[model samples]
Target: MSDDSNAAGAVEHREVVVIGGGQAGLSMSWHLTARGIDHVVLERDTLAHEWRDSRWDNFTLVTPNWQCVLPGYPYSGTDPDGFMSRAEVYDWVRAYADMFGPPVREHVEVVSVTQSHGGGFDLETTAGPLRADQVVVAVGGYHVPTIPRFAEKLPHGIEQLHSAEYRNADALPDGGVLVVGTGQSGAQIAEDLHLEGRAVHLATGDAPRVARFYRGRDCVAWLQDMGHYDIPIQQQPGGLGKRENTNHYVTGRGGGRDIDLRRFATEGMSLYGRMVDIVDGTAVFEPTLTRSLDAADAVAESIKDSIDVHIARLGIDAPVEARYRPVWRPEREITELDLRAADIATVIWSVGFRTDYRWLRVGVFDGAGHPCHHRGVTDIAGLYFLGLPWLHTWGSGRFAAIARDAEHLGERIAAGAREKAAA
Candidate 1:
């Protein structure tokens, strides 16, 4: 045991230390505790910091409540189909932390994580220093927000907020808001603005969407029943496995709101393809607005088709939803948005996030600066990662997936420990 860090120099040693207090770290803590591993969790903020602050006010879990299966603490709620609000999620996470009582050091920011001269790993935190025999990096992928270089070229009048920073429509100034990258964050933010009756433009891409409810069932339930989430990364269909990760257009609000760009277009929202460049004062966009819309439509329709076919084959009488066609939208490519003329005051960059491993002084990172680990185990002994997207299966980042992945990694850590003792 060691004392808490102070302003002065202080160093604490542990058998294992997990970085991040989100679902990943907490899961690791649970398994480690079960294995009697003398480990501590170092949290940068409160438990699930991103869920605590980074998410929007109206945010809800993209996955349904049933899938929120924490180790030894699964959701026993009656309404498994219902989505939990952001506040509810934060409280749930806090309660889960309290239940098992993971030795968590809160408000402790790890400035650097590197190999120690003696052995194992050394972490320099805001408090002081922490030494550990084994290190588990459980930080989720969305550590850094991705922004384009052309953003600098935009005029001073346009206020900017990354998806991480966006809270609600009330925060924005009283002009139109342009949302770039219509992924989950972008679509949700745009929906917020749209519902508020604020003029909004959605910069889109080849975004894919799945119906919230399919065949008289929750869309997630159908997928679970179909074993869609269990599909391995290599076995993913339609070359989905080839991509590192795709920002699928899924929303938790609006009763499983179908986030179609065309629907937004019909509802007085401007739908534009990718923001290509900001030349002079005008924001130029890609000429693939139709192509993006078609891609989104294809995903929506394909999911429905699969469900209809499956239910029919199983002889399960399920209600089918009417297929949605393209709504009224601009026929020509909306390649430019004159920020001044269009009264666009704010630009919410909801494109995506990048992994930041600069502080981690290890050779485990790939060229893209992502941790190079198979399923969670790194090449280096006593080093592992968790909460990464598609680390094992399509469900790798989800609630249930985290617990399973953590258990696997936790057993591996224990085996390594046993081997070390024998050596």
Candidate 2:
């Protein structure tokens, strides 16, 4: 779409502009295209670049193959339970674009998105400038790396990398690697490094864990049957604050393995409590190792009990015993892990991400830098967000669940377009 310009040269305009080319952006595009909405997708890199580059070599979706959901393209592969590697995920995203052929512009980095004096946005891009009547910021949550500032206290001799920058164990320097923040990425990366024979030190607080498979079916299978993904945003336990922190401990390797702090503590890897600070070239830690392990085990037991209850209610012939390895409860571990003394040369921070809204110059964002939206509708008429974690459900940020949210946002955008045209 092009607009007749007065002073800013010939400007390209469209009814809608989606800011990312990942699943969220593409899914939004598919919905917009289906409803005859004219829109463009701007990708700073190739499609699914973050999935291609941000994950490690052994990385796979925690959810199953059947959960590979999209607007029009559902998973048609044979093995629905199988997990996809990084390369395979890239292929899946590429195939989606080929099938839909959404209007996508690659390598066009959006430098800034300022509101025009008129309605809509003035987008300054690396490839020049354009404008759009509606803008959907589907850039996802992992736009920026969130490393603790205290990491700067470490001696330069100690190498450090965030989970986004870490590729594999071999890429790290020699000696033990201190992996901080034992969420999904941290737990997975620690396993990766430890499996690679690198001395591993996992520094973390109490993060809950769950057996990948419980009873006779996968844990996700039970979650799906119980309609876990369909739960509303407000009805969820822990309310809104816990929404940002409930990334569970699980992995997709070896037919969905059960992983937790206690399991890692017994794998010959040193486990420490939360890192407090660094003093005199020594990295200090909190004394919560036992507490962390016990807390994780309690959660795991609770999940297992829930699964058992469901199985009994359904009269399913699933096994009474857990199908995987028994959870390993190591002794009360060391509270302090001396980085230099332990010969730890590399520290991989698997401490989650922050939304990079630097390009957004809108007033709709909250004090936390999160957009204020009602199912992707920001207060500003033409601005929206998609692929946000817990935007609508627990699965909003994931590939298996983005399509539903995208479809909702797409309809919203289309309605806005119709209103503009009618006016």
Candidate 3:
């Protein structure tokens, strides 16, 4: 090894540089440290700040506490049946870092990570430029919230915000609330506002495939125990791959929680079909799928009952049955002019998230903005990815699913570093 002054006389470099100090980055750090490897973690903010700051105040993890554990620590709270609040999860990640004392440089925003010659990287950050032999891109998938382009032209009275920006019911306008999208976040936000005594209107899209539980257990636990997380991204079988590929409709939160959308339905929750535009205060709905409304409501009832039973058995205090209003057809639709009306106040867009890799200048990403990795191994040598949805397999990037990929990637990087040193 060389002294700092001697090394500076040559060039600045770290052995391995892991980006994004969220759960995935920290998990990788844990494994790297366990193997006695030297590395540094560069974070855009203080560790777990995304969860601490970005998540809504009423937000609780969709997954149960038991399924929330990472590589080095288990969820150690007393409320196993209770869902973990975002603050709790953030604190847990911070504690994990403190206990392991991973070499994390906080507040160092990485502006760009460009590959240099000879399989190295020049990471340009807010602090300054630094070089590293290896880099791991661990920025999460849901960092950016997408709003429909048509929403921009809507009148000022109809407030528009993504689900990420929604904190609670009070964030909406004085009149009825319109929640666009049927994914987990959208449904939960709509339900929260309805319970808070707002006229809630949920705009329907393609409802995702949902399961009340997985294999007679909480869906999350079943995934963990079945080693869904252990399935290598390259080796994931067909079913889970399909499930992951499909949106799985609902949020990742399991049973025994309070995100009961059906309860809101029973309480006069108005529904609308597909949205075409927001002309005035109204979101125009499609008319094609009108015939299937009743059937969809039936399916929703079954889903709600199943959730109620699960929570009841576990003794969790979630409202099981509240009849919500259905605004549009269940099958298809042409358009409705409801959004242009002045009645709707807030529009919560709860659509899914997209991964962004533009900062990574390496040619490792496909056209769809996803990294090209076969089980977390990128095409660029010394560069890798972790905690990506379907990065390896169906369950590769779930809450409990991240540890295995972290371990594997850590080992591969260490081995590659050793081989390079020998060469």
TM-score, every prediction:
0.94, 0.95, 0.83
TM-score: the better of candidates 1 and 2: 2
TM-score, candidate 2, is 0.95
Candidate lDDT (C-alpha), each: 0.83, 0.83, 0.70
Mind giving the per-residue lDDT tens digits that candidate 2 earns over 329-350?
A: 5455565566788898998888
- Ranking of candidates on lDDT, top first: 1, 2, 3
Higher-lDDT candidate of 1 and 3: 1
The residue pairs that clash in candidate 2, if any, are none
Question: Model 3, 1-423: lDDT tens per residue?
Answer: 114415544555777889989999999999988887777888987888888777777677766777676787888889875677777788888898888898999999888988887778988888777788888888866767878889887776668788888887776658877788776677767766766888888776655434445334555554454455566545544632443353434443333433334445556786667676866544677752343244445654565455556666667664334454544323334366555453876778887677677788889876676667777788788899887777766555567667877988988988988998899
- The C-alpha stretches of model 3 lying farther than 4 A from their native spots are 1-11, 209-217, 222-263, 288-334, 340-342
Model 3 lowest lDDT segment of ten: 239-248
Q: How many residue pairs clash per model?
A: 0, 0, 34
